[model samples]
Target: MTGTRFDPSWFEAHHVNLSATERRAATLTTRRTVKKDWQAAWLAQAITCIDLTTLAGDDTPSRVQRLCAKARQPLRDDIMAALGLDALRVGAVCVYPTMVAHAVKALEGSGVPVASVATGFPAGLMPLSLRLAEINYAVDQGASEVDIVITREYALTGQWSKLYDEIAAMREACGPAHMKAILATGDLQTLGNVYKASMVAMQAGSDFIKTSTGKEGLNATLPVSLTMVRALRDFREKSGQIVGFKPAGGIKSAKDAIAWLILMKEELGTRWTRNDLFRFGASSMLGDIERQLEHHVTGRYSAANRHAMA
Candidate 1:
């Protein structure tokens, strides 16, 4: 009877995967997100400001690397001179997996958390077991947060089930630490696709949904961030689960950071804070924020000043 009633090709074609109603319900969640008020959001910057420092890049120019090393030593000694560094910061230094130890060593007594990217990041092309081993290795090396990538190939192929399964397995491998699922929105190709990927990411146990790996071409853009914000806002309503959002790549200024701030306000409201649910995966951004903060307080930007700590 079952065989008589089912046709293989017909079953594949007629799979009632998600009815229009269910699809819409999965999206456009009912819970209202914190309305976007740039002034209000910026006003609340007292506690929401985070100094995101990510150092993974494609073109790791030796000149810049030498410059950062030079900056690191003096910056470590001169941090007290900076306004933000002098204040209570949610101390964190994010870096590539290979540099986890370097970052951990950089902020030893500063109480900052160390975050590193794993699982064949940017491209997400390695084997699943290898990705798990990378996570375990990073944790073993003392990284508090592990940013992993979803299997974009599967998601792009419209294999939602495979995408969900991969993310879930990665989440399980994270084991006690926070898992930031980099959606790689730029590669996903559409806001609609971004939303769908975001949903699958959260459902599969992503503690945070990130925008990019900073290695891709169209890393982080406002439209993509907006798409992710809307998705998170909707997911929160339907599942009562709060997830963090991180926009990395091509983010090089404080102005860009402010836009993300405003977007989070519009999408998630007051829940967007330092520890609760917000982070920027950045490399050159900290120096920029510090420069802007100095410009805000001093009316001038320092072209030569390369490190916030310095």
Candidate 2:
């Protein structure tokens, strides 16, 4: 099928059912990771948060540029503070390049990190060196994590080597920061492409391999997330290597977050801790999750009670 279209079965072949013992082992791992001081230290992490700058990309009179700018600091702070104050493990705060420092500074000491999108993000349309520079600049400015989008065209066309190089370049650029490689899964034709992309991304040194850019038509989905989580699990078993998983884009609400958590429980199981193991990568999701927490904790919800970070 070199010249033919990619088939999802090409990937399904390796994803067989686990044995009873294997399943039990997976459950134990999940309990350990999920049960860790999680209630007091981080409850929202029961569903990781998200990265959202493009929410301003719509055609509203709200002005995308200024909205993006405002969403930069206030959104990050709002997310961090709400999660922080609620005693939920605040997930990382994601931001665009210029505002990463603000996200970094605002999230300081909260155990929440600053995640910056880079490497010709969204479009992945730029020179290799320039992309690397963008990554380095963000990390140097205090981003604890770097999310770099892969050239979807390259991955789709079987240009695995080029894709590998881009991942490696971005990894090097991140220095000590965790590098999350965005597959922009919607652009790919099949699950096989996502599988191949995930393996290649991890092999090329990405600390985490994400499912979508949140800019793609479909963004993240259960099937797509299941594909990546399974890939990461298998890769870990054989290589004794652990790679993180993130399902970004379109994820809003506690139910969506719980569904993703269920997928992680069934697929990757316990190693899915609060940090690099998983994250939501959203803009508005934190607030939604907060409302859920408030309802669960205090049994009341009012628009006036919603806290916004100054």
Candidate 3:
């Protein structure tokens, strides 16, 4: 994945008006509608773009193995046949650094990549050296992708230079593994901050810019997502480079997934909807999507219990 060259001045000069951003975000949901089979198809696409994740303190090897099995075959056999999708699968399986080995072992023959959240994940407060080492460890343990959290203090304090340098080092540690820089937008406080941070991460060579860590008080919201998407558009226009986007946390339903997919298509066009360019960092969301697909095919809503993650 080629990354854009770092340009601190470009990000420092960026500005985002909150009111206009909110207005645009409000209309995203009502702007387009995908109904019936079209909606089902969109949901299937959403499934393929999901980074099926299990980031928990109590996550075990068995749990990681089960999650890998689900990632390999995201949809049940009946649902896949009904949708005429014989080879459906999630984009990747994300787990903690320690769980990366387990996930890799379980998904050995499958093509699904194992993603590990590193760099003091969720709360990137550790020292830079340690964070970088953690990333190396995860990659050595067989992680194809590393989701690293940025130091929110840099964004909060308007330290664009520091933020850019930090992300650049993390990217270097990732080496061959793709890097997703989580901005933890919920803590950034403003849309403008979100936009600037997005630019900094992209400029610093992040393959993807993620919305949240799913451990924050608030996570991926429509308005914040819009701000970040527009930032991606600007980055692509100025540098002629395309980067992926991931809206994590608080997205838990088929309807919510379609909403984000529509946002990507409408804002960045069709190219951003694919797994290579977009992803959902979710755990329980797959279950809801499966339930909706079942309803679409069988015309009967099944209990949530019937669609377990593993």
Candidate 4:
């Protein structure tokens, strides 16, 4: 979804109530307990919304191919059949720009989109021209989605216009490929800054506003996610445009997955729980989820090695 025009005033007066946000986030996991079949259903739903990622310095073509294979069949055949399903696939496979071609070739005919992290991912310290070039390169290499990092310095210094301009340029570079603006909230310093950055990103045409790059000191947290979700809700109310949310970094385990699903359901309704509206930026989290599903099906847990990602 391409976004609307820049509007600064939409979030000018917005400030997060730290304690209040914390209080609400605290209740999401405990508010309602979905056990047995219901819990399995939620976990299965979470599997489809995952952006199965492997962004590392040691990444290789073979590794990416294996990752794509997992994306194609996240759950074992026995588990899928026991759950009474035909197939289960992840939302997308995310990789670095240079790995886009490899992922695309590997995931061919699998109905899975390849997402590449561009615009100097993780740090975004490169020059503007180079960053935009990186995005173009990834798209040219067959990336269906591009995750671009915003210049946190711009937001930290309160230069909203600058942030909008750069992100807009990145969005333009993305062309038809979906753009996910990675705000790296861990470095933004405050929830208020997080809200404004989310507004600016959606205004600049980001299809999704991500919580982090998964490299920050403090990655995704419930309070930060709540702030961004509220901002997206406000933007939707004012502009009538819906943008997706992705909370990445340090989100592992089946319990964490359910907690995020709960957050989306309680705050934005069932629509946000879909892959098109919400995604979990995760890697190891899938293994734990598979283990839990196995337990639900067989009444016994399996070893982590049995559910290897790649």
The numbered model that scores best in lDDT is 4
- TM-score of every prediction relative to native: 0.75, 0.75, 0.98, 0.99
Give the top-scoring candidate (TM-score).
4
Please list the C-alpha lDDT of all candidates, in the order they appear.
0.64, 0.66, 0.93, 0.94
**What are the per-residue Cα lDDT tens digits for candidate 2 across 1-310?**
0011223333435443335334543444345443323442344554344444432333332333333333333323444464455343345656677776655555556566667888877888998889988998988888888889988888689887777777776787788888889999999877777888887787778888898888888988777777687788766765577888888888876566666666666666756855558777665565565565555455566462373321
Q: What local lDDT score does residue 229 receive in model 1, on the 0 to 100 scale?
A: 73
- Sort by lDDT, top down from the best: 4, 3, 2, 1
Clashing pairs in 1: 36-266, 54-282, 91-112
On lDDT, the stronger of 1 and 4 is 4
Name the regions of candidate 3 deviating beyond 4 angstroms: none
| CA lDDT, candidate 4, residue 157 | 98
Report the lDDT tens digits of candidate 3 across residue range 1-310.
5666667777676778889888988898887999989999999999999999988889999999999999999888999898888798899999999999999999998889999999998899999999999999999999999999999999999898899899999999999999999999999998889999999999999999999999999999999999999989999998898999999999999989999999999999999999999999987889999999999999999999999899
Candidate 2 regions exceeding 4 Å error are 1-43, 47-86, 300-310
Q: Tell me how many clashing residue pairs each candidate has.
A: 3, 12, 0, 0
Judged by whole-model lDDT over C-alpha atoms, candidate 3 comes out at: 0.93
Q: Where in model 4 is the C-alpha error above 4 Å? A: none
Clashing pairs in 4: none
List model 1 lDDT by residue over 44-68, tens digit each.
3522344355453552434333433
Question: Native-vs-model 4 lDDT?
Answer: 0.94
Model 1 stretches with alpha carbons more than 4 Å out: 1-86, 306-310
